[model samples]
Target: MSKLAWLNGLPLEEAKAEFLRCCGSTRWAEAMARARPFKTDTAVYSEAGWLWSQTSTEDWREAMAHHPRIGDVSKLRERFKASGAWSEQEQKGVQGAGEDVLQGLADGNREYEERFGFIFLICATGKSAQEILEQLRERIKNPPALELRIAAGEQAQITRIRLEKLLTSP
Candidate 1:
């Protein structure tokens, strides 16, 4: 879909404010602000792409603090629901795969957390269990700097999806 129309009607200030709330780290906040006036949805996503590229490992870790471990995602969903940022539909979208996949995510999550002290962060919307698993497996051996970059990229994807939802709202 064209994000151009969505951009035109967006309350830029309000949208930025909400984006800031969802993602509060300084660089991410700045990137969202700077990404306004996107000519297309793809362009907006491009900003996310850039944000991940430019982010430092420290900043990525800071951003990850906003999310929970992958397997523990249910609690994150509950938190989002309670905060009114998530509806049933959105929650379901986040949980886009099977329990077995979640179980794998949990195992991966545990190993990752043990290795890194932070949750395994990925942008789960629209991804299948196998796809996510592949990523998780590949990411397991990433060096700290590389993993942070990859994780931040995934976070940026999630941020963009959530931001798009705001534009689609009444």
Candidate 2:
């Protein structure tokens, strides 16, 4: 059977677990599981977006907690072992980054967390480290309320990508 079919046929708790792998918010995962039997990839994507928008800041923070700081290879391998492989792939640009760039990312991550009270989040799928750093530099200047929403929006994009990966990965 196809992946979508497999997902649709899973038991409720199992389905929630799979959805949780895509996005860490328990509320979003539970809701997505209950909204199952999606007819098409587009429908799944649409539902994911809608469900993410319905999530609260606390829920967004829960999802954000799942991601390692960009360029932190050790954290990716050790702390976030469950999602490490996928995250490593998404952050491929960091693999060949120079020491200065890596150091900048580390410092920026600290500053961002201190300011926003959460990790800086970006889609990171196809972005270079320099690009991500530039974005972090820019986005860090936003006010707390606006930055939270922007980070949540980035999480939404990440959820869509991970949903596609979940459906397509064997």
- Per-candidate Cα lDDT values, in order, are 0.65, 0.92
**Local accuracy of candidate 1 as per-residue lDDT tens digits, 1-170:** 44456554557675556555455455766667666776766676667667766767777777777665554544755655432343233334436567778778778878888887777777756666567677888898999777866777777766676666755655
Residue runs of model 1 more than 4 Å from their true location after superposition: 1-16, 21-24, 30-53, 81-100
Query: Estimated TM-score per prediction?
Result: 0.66, 0.97
- After aligning candidate 1 to the native by TM-score, how far in Å is the CA of 136 from where it should be? 1.4
Model 2 agreement with the true structure over 26-49: per-residue lDDT tens digits: 999999999999999899999999
TM-score of 2: 0.97
Q: Which candidate number would show the highest TM-score if scored against the true structure?
A: 2
Model 2 lDDT, full chain set: 0.92
